[model samples]
Target: MPRVEVAEQPGVGLDGSARPSEDVVVVRPDAVIVLDGATSLRTDLPSGGWYASRLAAAIAERLEEPHPADPADVLAAAIRAVSAENGFVAGHSPSSTVALLRWTETAVDALVLGDSPVIAFGPGGPTVLADDRLAAVPRRGGGGYRTRLRSGAGYGPDHVAALRESGAAMDRLRNREGGFWVAEADPAAAYRARRARWPRAEVHAVLMATDGVSCGVDDYQIFPDWQAVLDLARRHGPRAVLDRVRAAERSDPDGSRWPRPKPHDDQVLVLVEDMALA
Candidate 1:
């Protein structure tokens, strides 16, 4: 069995009430699962966090069922259940991004929906398992692409100028038209899961995190160094990282620290290790 560790923080609201952020790290008979909820600014209720927690719980329950189905099928069923439970009609109010990791004796499978990222670190570096939803936005002219700053340090006149130039680059990208795009969570297509073998030599750690944690993260496009992140979490605890990200966003004038909006979204990070140690 694999042991899992999870951390999460809440978001502040207008009336001084802090909305709950949902996260879970569970070890089921089939696999270890990590999930994060997506909060929307448009909603009056706390659907994001609410759904995140509910979804994770539901997934866990399904996995524990006598005849657990495929991970992908189970996820799709959960999405449909949420829609029925909430009366959330099609093309309307959705809940959260989903990231799941299923480990069998021979192979491991990963499934993700939306921009929330999941990463795996083996003997080499980190291999990103999911896509960043925001990366799909088209630049102004489609000539260049806009890159978000990892932190306050990424902001400046030069970066701003590049952002403007990237508008054209984005337009160019739009013209090509044959690339991956981030669309709304598809309870169906997002169901396609990927699988890979766990190398006996180099499998060390796998990290699953919501986008909020990515705000202050660097070299993330590549596999992030798990030890370094673990060190930070150990010294300051998870909330410390969220605090720094919030401060970094506030320090920037351009609002470039988007996604890291004030009050900040709930940050969820889950770290997993191979069961060989056990």
Candidate 2:
């Protein structure tokens, strides 16, 4: 048997407004799913938060069916279901990143799209499954693109316009040639996601997290490594890891230390422990 626990927290925008968090966490006896909705650059379509929640629910429903299916097939089906329900056209709606893990009596399977990650801890140590192609997209403004968004001195209308143009360019590259893939309206992208499998006896625990919780280690270097993260979760639970991330973000409110587009992002973490040891 496996025991699962989860924790989540919504992030506030720069304007000090409360909006729905775009992260979703789903846990089952033999599986875990984590999704992070991409922020929408267009205003004419549904918000990413709405898309993520709906997609997550759809995936959950599919997983509940008696017949087992490949994770990629399940995700593809869920994407189509959500798109049909919302009347969203491909390449015109909001999208999300996905990370999934499923375990059976003999093996464990995993998938990752966009940047969210699924990590497995085994007798050999920890193995991280992530997709970094999205982050490799070229930026037009070198490194100061995020700094220009702040008001007071360096902000300018031209900078904002440039940022918008850059965003549009990135959107075009999505799900196309020389570009990365995500859980968008296009079901074909699901097949392009990274996938892996391992013997069930080799894994002791697993963790699925959106970028918000992972950024603390991958981006901020707040902790020494991923092992530190697992240890913290084991001692204080998933919320403790999220609280540490929020505290780190608060300390760098100006983005001086970490130059990211948003001050904080919605955080979601799920931990699955193998109960056989107990």
Candidate 3:
């Protein structure tokens, strides 16, 4: 068994209103799963947060059916089931990134679909499992919105228009070949997740996080590296890491410094440590 510590907070929208976080975390006896739903800008479709809750439930249900089910297989089945439940069409449905880490008596397994990542700390050093396809895909001036925000534009009517414009543009590339894969209505996307395995004895701890929390390291440089993140989580608990992310956001409230989509995004972190390591 592993000792799990977690901390999560809902995102604050541009208006400074708290919204239910689209991030989900599932801690099974043998696995830790994290999902970060993309924010839904379209009114016709269901919200990403709502879709993520249903997907998380589906995933949890499938994990209990048999022992050590392949994470990719489980995710595919869940996506199929969830898609059927909502009768959603590909390229038009809400989506979420996935990060999964499962452990058995002999091995540790990790899978990452989309931007959410899973980091495993073992005797061999830290191993990161992440899918960067969404980021790697080319876009039409993808940084334009952020740059606008940083240039004293602020989050106002123009920001909303820019969001709509970017969202429509990205819709064409989503789920398409050579573009990016995410957990939407397409079950095949789950199979495209990144995967890795390691000897159970070698792994001492695992860290799973949604992009909101990870942006602190990946974008804002809040802690330097993943090793530093692990050190903080192990020493001060997962809450400490979240606090650091929040503080960073607070310092740049108007998006003048970081120029993010929103002032504060939904944040969630999970640290699973081997009991033997304790």
Question: Relative to the true structure, how large is the alpha-carbon lDDT of every model?
Answer: 0.56, 0.82, 0.85
Weakest lDDT window of 10 consecutive positions for candidate 3:
138-147
| Residue 270's lDDT in candidate 1 | 72
**Poorest lDDT segment (10 consecutive residues) of candidate 1:** 174-183
Candidate 2 Cα errors over 4 Å, as ranges: 142-144, 147-163, 275-278
Candidate 3: tens digits of C-alpha lDDT, residues 205-225: 888998888888888998898
Worst 10 residues of 2 by lDDT: 150-159
Better of 2 and 3 by TM-score: 3
Q: lDDT winner between 1 and 2, please give it.
A: 2
Show model 3 residue runs off by greater than 4 Å. 275-278
Q: What TM-score would candidate 1 get against the native?
A: 0.68
Write candidate 2's Cα lDDT for 1-278 as tens digits. Answer: 78898999998643445788888877777778888988776779777778888998898888888876899999999999998888877788899999988877888999999899888898778899989888787666543456554432222344445556677888888988688899989998899999989888888888888999889889899987778999999999989999999999898875657756567788998888882343
Model 1 misplaced stretches (Cα beyond 4 Å) = 14-17, 22-30, 43-46, 139-186, 192-202, 218-227, 230-260
In terms of TM-score, the best-performing candidate is 3
Q: Over the full model, what C-alpha lDDT does candidate 1 score relative to the true structure? A: 0.56
User: Which candidate's lDDT is highest?
Assistant: 3
Q: Which digits, one per residue and each the tens of the lDDT, describe model 1 over residues 1-278?
A: 66666666665532224665555456565566666554444444445666676777777888877777877788877766766676765444435666777665555567766556666766666677765433655334432222344333343455545554553343333212343321123456444434344543354566777766765564222214545665566576656556665566556544444422233545777766663343
RMSD of each: 6.8, 2.5, 1.8
